[model samples]
Target: MYRLLIADDEQLEREAIKFIIEESFPGSFTICEAANGLEVVEIALAFKPDLLFLDIKMPGINGLQAAAQINRVLPECRIIIVTAFHYFNYAKEALSLGVVDYITKPAPPEAVVETVKRLIVELESASFKERLAAEREQQLQQITGYFEDDLLVLIAYGEIEAKEIEDYFAILNLQAQTFFAAVATILYPNTPGASILEIEKRVLNKNVVGWVKEYMQKVGRQAYIRSIGAEVFILLLAEENLDEYQARLTGMRLFTELKEALWKEQQIALNIGIGGLCNETGQIGQAFSQAKYALRYEAAPDSIISYGDIERDQQQVFYPYHREKRLYQSILQGDIHASQQLLEDLLTWLREHTSCLEAFQQKVYVGAPRQLTLQIIDCAGSKQMVGPAVDAFAAQNPNIKIDYIIGTSPELPSKIKAQQMAGNVETNVVLTGYDAMGSGLVQQIWERIMPEQKKSFPNLEDNYLPAAKAAFDLFDGYGIVFAWCPGGPMFTYNPDRVKNVPRTTDELLAWCKANPGKFMYPRP
Candidate 1:
């Protein structure tokens, strides 16, 4: 229901308008009446009416003057001028004041009803649009969160490309050029040879990321936080040129507050390493390295160390951060020989620095896949196949990281297309069936393998079965066949309702023709 206010100097005129409205709309409106301009303005302020009818001539303050005052406060209120004269000047002034319509003294009931109906339609439409906009905003925020997580993963692995960064910047509306990386490590129980998974469970159960985010908000800083195993990577963004002093100050404050908060909430201690300021977009990896380097000196729990505090000879210190990253990537890609060589080199260097290899064993994370990440969206209902395929793949390629989500086939094409149009496409791979494949084909969003790249998998099609090969041919290089299920379309009906089920295409057609509303099918 909406509020309606009728204002006039004459009591008879107000009654007539009210009777007409009540007769037409019935219980649609909560109607109010005002005898003069002052009374109307006061009632408008209190009632916040959706519609108003104002007489042009009133005692002292006129209707136009009252409307101007009301318009300032309740701009959304629809006002109609009720006047004794049909002067063009009054009509012009009413329009200037945002009056929807003007009805002369003793308005026809039809004219009054018509004007009210039109305004009601407009108000309803505007309200619907507002609700729709709010819903879209909520969905956009969720997508932004996903992009943020993806960006942090990319930054942590140091594999972020310029285009990928640009896309994220557009999605996040990041106007900052300067950034610094911070690594917060959980000071878990000093159990001999503790696994990363075990350590993560202990800290993650306490929700350290949530605490860190809360502290960040309290301090009014912009940063992306990602929890990887036992460590949390924070990429702090700055709009202006951040000097080393300012960066260190920010890190100290953030880490100090975070450290205190964690201990207070869950008795979990955090040791943070703050890297130096980096202005370039591509040098975030360097910041991460510096943070990791600083973290090595964290001798005790609740320790906060900055790269600037560490005094080391840059030329003498042997830190193969990039080589170690490459080794991890190699292991993820199932390159045994390259990873073996890299591992030997790292061990040989470790042997020279330390007397016993036993001490270094505790520092290294065994059986942990922390380097590369992939996000997979599946719409084919192939979880039983893809889950084991990914596990088997991970078993051989131990360093590869995968995040999977199941989606509906009908929504995948449009969702992905919308993401692309918004300049933030998050799906790395889409595992979908033929119906969605047809939709994707029309959308033209899929990335096709070029002829040159086909050399890497020379005999790809020859290994497939006949039916699978036919499906692959239909894709036209957009997708590949990983598995096949032998099944035909089946009908679903109540046993008591339909004793004889449709056995063939003709039977289904006949059933559908006979029972139009009862027989329904999903999109092809």
Candidate 2:
């Protein structure tokens, strides 16, 4: 039910309007009455009525003045003007104030009923739109959290393009020119029971994570914190040209405060390790490694350790750059045998020169023959537009291959799934309409792929159109949408039979209503 307010200095006028509403529409409104403009303003503010009716002439303040005040307080309320005279100037002024209806005193029951019905429809539509907007905002916030977590995980262990990072920074409003990684380990009793472990995890996740996030926000810093292990949490501090010494000092101070709080509140102890700052995000893996190494030191309980303090003098390792280049070129030229022979010779040389087996293994793994193949399944029927560019990419990356397949939209999903079930490699990349992704096919395939592979794709926002990128995100990082072309409904009419053909759906609906038997559409 909706709230309604009736305001008039004349008792009979107010009673008449109330009777008309109650009789015309039963149980549709909860009505309130006011004698003058001042009472109208007060009642409207308190009741927050959906619809208001006010007489143009009142004792203290006029209907127009009351309406202005009500509008300022509750702009969503719909207002109607009731007057004894049908003055043109009064109607104009009421219209300027956005009054929904202007009815002269002694309005018929039918006029009042029709006006109320129209306003009800308008109010319902506005309320629905407001709810839909709020829901979309909430969904966007959830998506943002998932995106931030995925980006940080990829940065710490995998390779990502610089352009993708820049795009993410723009979208997230982060001024991340430099960053430093830190790891926090919670110290618990040795061989603790399952219940103890569970309780500690819950406490750390609820209290520590929330406190750190809130503190960073209060200090105007952007930090991404995630639990990377059972008892460890990793934090990436982002800033614009951060001072190295000051950053280390800040990290130590934050860890000290956190340790004190944990002991005082929950009787828990924490040890933190801070890594040296790096300017590029691609080097995050190195920073994480350094932090882990620093954490290996024997430090006092609830203390902070910096990687620089426990330095190591290590022997330098040599890389066969020229040999690796030739090997890659050979593979690009499709000379598999020659590439294999070069790789074997390089491994032998490393084994003979390097005394450390770990060093040799690292070199061999880094220089191994790498290949990536992307299968393009086009459901949008725009293969010709994007095929050549994909071929060019294959040519440039020589080690990578691109295969294109064209199919109708309906058959694409099942075909991909059938191939996966048959132990055959299906399309790793997809170029389909937004409808296909929205239909849940993309999500099905996403469940099968590894998490790391999903994070390997570049930022979708920087690469695709806004609408297309959003469609790809339906999979939440499962698939990459490299191309899209919008398609919509098309209408045709005979010019000879139809005059002034409608150009929009609304106009077409109105036209069809006027000439019902003259319009027809083909069955799908």
Candidate 3:
């Protein structure tokens, strides 16, 4: 709803304009009135109305002056001048003062209604654009967050090149030139009766990574974290490189706070290892190694081990945690090339570090299903009708997952045909209208539900209404009428305005001709 202010010294003029608007466009506006020029400016500023009607010849500092002041403060407020005279100078001044239009005194109700209607349309259009822009910005932010996570994973995995880091930084719009790396290892307690898997599930299955991210943000640190199985790698970005002492102090403070919080609140224990400062993007891999090296030391669970304090001579055993996570992420994102390259890297590592039989066994299980998504293309606004049926189907067939893509009746068939032509049939099922079903039948896009399949639903025909049965018959065995309703042409008319209800198209046309500007109908 929009706010509207009508300012005039003549109370009747204000009332006339208010009545005209209320009768024509009820519930569209919240209205206010002003008796004089001072009241007009004061109420306009305080109310912050969207549209204002100001009388030109008002007592003390006329309408033009009030409009000028209001425009300075509320530039978006549309001003309409209400004047008794149609003098050229008055219009010229009103236009110069940014008045949208002028209403001559004793204006027709139709003219007043039309002006408000046009302004409302303009306001709605502007509001829609604002909402669209906000949604776009929100989507951009979400995409940026995904890119940040991918970059952090790459840094920790030691697979990203210097050029790739630069490109990521540019995409993320990051100002940080240096960063610190830390590795946090979740250490499950050795329970007497509980199994290792039980303990791990209780601790690791909790959103520990999410907690750490939220905690880091609360502590005012710009950090990115990625969980790789039992360990989480943290990248704390900085605008400049920190000295050895500063890095140690900062790391100890953050790690100690995190360690205490997790143990005290959730009974989760963390053994953290802090790496030395990284001066450039290329040094992130080395820093990751340092953090891992520091993590291997047999330190107290609460105590954070810094690489600067650890001995450099000892070599830490290589782990494929990062590489495995990178490969998993690549596969999930459908980056086939990256997945193949990472698979090769893992195979090479296995060749050097393990036996041939072990490598062969691992390779054999590479394509095992971890997660799968089933996509369904559906007509818009049909979710409420189809959602419960889909839910029931999913409940009975628990293994089948479903996702929906909403489209128009015409658009759904085009999208499915396009996907089929591209040799990537993403749409597993289509929930659409009869028009699209008929179109799909013509396009040979639908297959008949065979007689063998009908055996499973022996009572399906008995349950269907006659309308649905008729629709099914029209499909010629290519489709089934999942839902149906019986409805015909309908009309609604005001009894006072429309004395004789038209029963046919010819009668309706005759009535429209007899009483001009008295007919209304919705577009198909």
Candidate 4:
């Protein structure tokens, strides 16, 4: 639910705004109010409300001061000015402080409600389908932060407090009899300079969005919608019946509408993964995870892949793990051209090899070993700073996970005397989800702290890494051995254990000796 904080000296005004917001958004928000500026600051910080409504002519610490103080503390909290007169100068100053909009006193509740809705939309826009043009390590850091803060944390996952969470179950226990949830994953292209916010707003406006919204509009029902992973997902619970046929029909219509809107209206291709229904919210995560897994088996001959198909296919699977491993070996041997050509053949083999989408989604089950492949193509002799160009694009991307990935060059103009490495693949520069313009964090680090040292070995290119990314397209988030590592093995087994990282090779070897063949080091 959208959280709002109102700071009005007039108690009636606060109530009026509250009622206006309630009527406009209906059940989409939870609001908190304060009679004074100080109280407003307190509530806003504590609740972490998305929108703040303030009256300019307050008794103590007027609206402007409160806003400045609050803005200093919470840049994300957008302020709306409610003033008695046309304070042009005041509005200008408020805008400077990131006040969303200014309105005349006795503002219509509708107008107040509209402003809050837009801000929520804006927040969602910045995060839709962006990319981070940073190095691999930096991207990982960004991914972790997003998971901890924006993604998992907000949903009340493991130890986080969510009033919405309490209200979620309470409303159902007291009012509804049954619950159900279905998840959908969207796959969109990742590029630099693409505005995730702008694209998302357009996509959300597509009729497909309305189709889903209307499905949940019927009273005595609750539907929760949020963008997870790469797509928009919804949790639906029917109070009385299990219209399985109707639900499937609704999904089909939505899929059709979404496909049409995306292609004709948005000018993009979106692959959707739909899941079988679940009865409980706890089970819904597994359902969503399953759906996400289902998405990995992309490019199915048919659309609308479901969990049931996943079940039937598992019965007679072929090309087991042993065979998949051989394919990965070929890639590590620098047979990239061969792998690219075999893409279609490989997927076809997988389809013929597996029985259902479930087996396809879950690459390995039980004690089966995971398999992966790496393919690297030359950028076709592009100009210098191509990576930074990619970084520049990442800066503007909407759905990017990391904001501050270094993206300039890996060559330092000058080297410090103490520095042992220069003009090498710079060290991992980092960025986080907190940055608004975080594209350059990785590139800068790569050029400065260079990951490569000046080696006396004949094959120098073998040690220099041009780029590295944690490929979601790969198996279970494993590190793909770079193309330059042309050897028999395509993977350098993503160390299963990370509890201890030895600083010295001797220590690592002794640690390995203590454990006996438990570790593998990079070979040049």
Tell me, by lDDT, which candidate is best: 1
Candidate 1: which stretches are off by over 4 Å? 1-126, 188-206, 264-266, 297-299, 314-468, 476-524
Model 3 clash count equals: 0
For candidate 2, give the lDDT of residue 277.
71
Per residue, candidate 1 scores C-alpha lDDT tens digits across 6-106 of 99998767866887788789899999999988999999999999999998778969999999999899877888898644433243345546576678555
Per-candidate Cα lDDT values, in order, are 0.75, 0.67, 0.74, 0.50
Compute each candidate's TM-score over C-alphas: 0.47, 0.40, 0.38, 0.29
Estimate the TM-score for candidate 3.
0.38
Off by over 4 Å in 4: 1-164, 168-178, 185-207, 215-222, 226-230, 241-272, 312-524
Q: Which tens-of-lDDT digit does each residue in 1-524 have in candidate 3?
A: 89999999987678778867876887988999999899999999999999999887788888899998998998678888886544333443455465777776665677788899887877778484565446446656765776776676666656667778888888777767667889887877678986687555545734788898888789777888877546788888877667778877877787888889988888988888888777788777778888888887746665578887766555443546567877986875579999999899889887776645565557667765555567877773578888888889878766678887776674566566655433346788777666678667756666566343588668777888988888778877666667676775557778897678888766766675576445544321
For model 2, how big is the CA root-mean-square deviation?
19.8
- Estimate candidate 4's alpha-carbon lDDT, on a 0 to 1 scale: 0.50
Candidate achieving higher lDDT, 2 or 3: 3
Output the TM-score of candidate 2: 0.40
Lowest-sum lDDT 10-residue window in model 3: 84-93
Tens-digit lDDT track for model 2 on 92-178? Answer: 345445465678655566778899998888788857457544644665566566556655554444234456666766656676666
Q: Could you tell me how far off, in angstroms, the CA of residue 381 lies in candidate 2 after the best superposition? A: 38
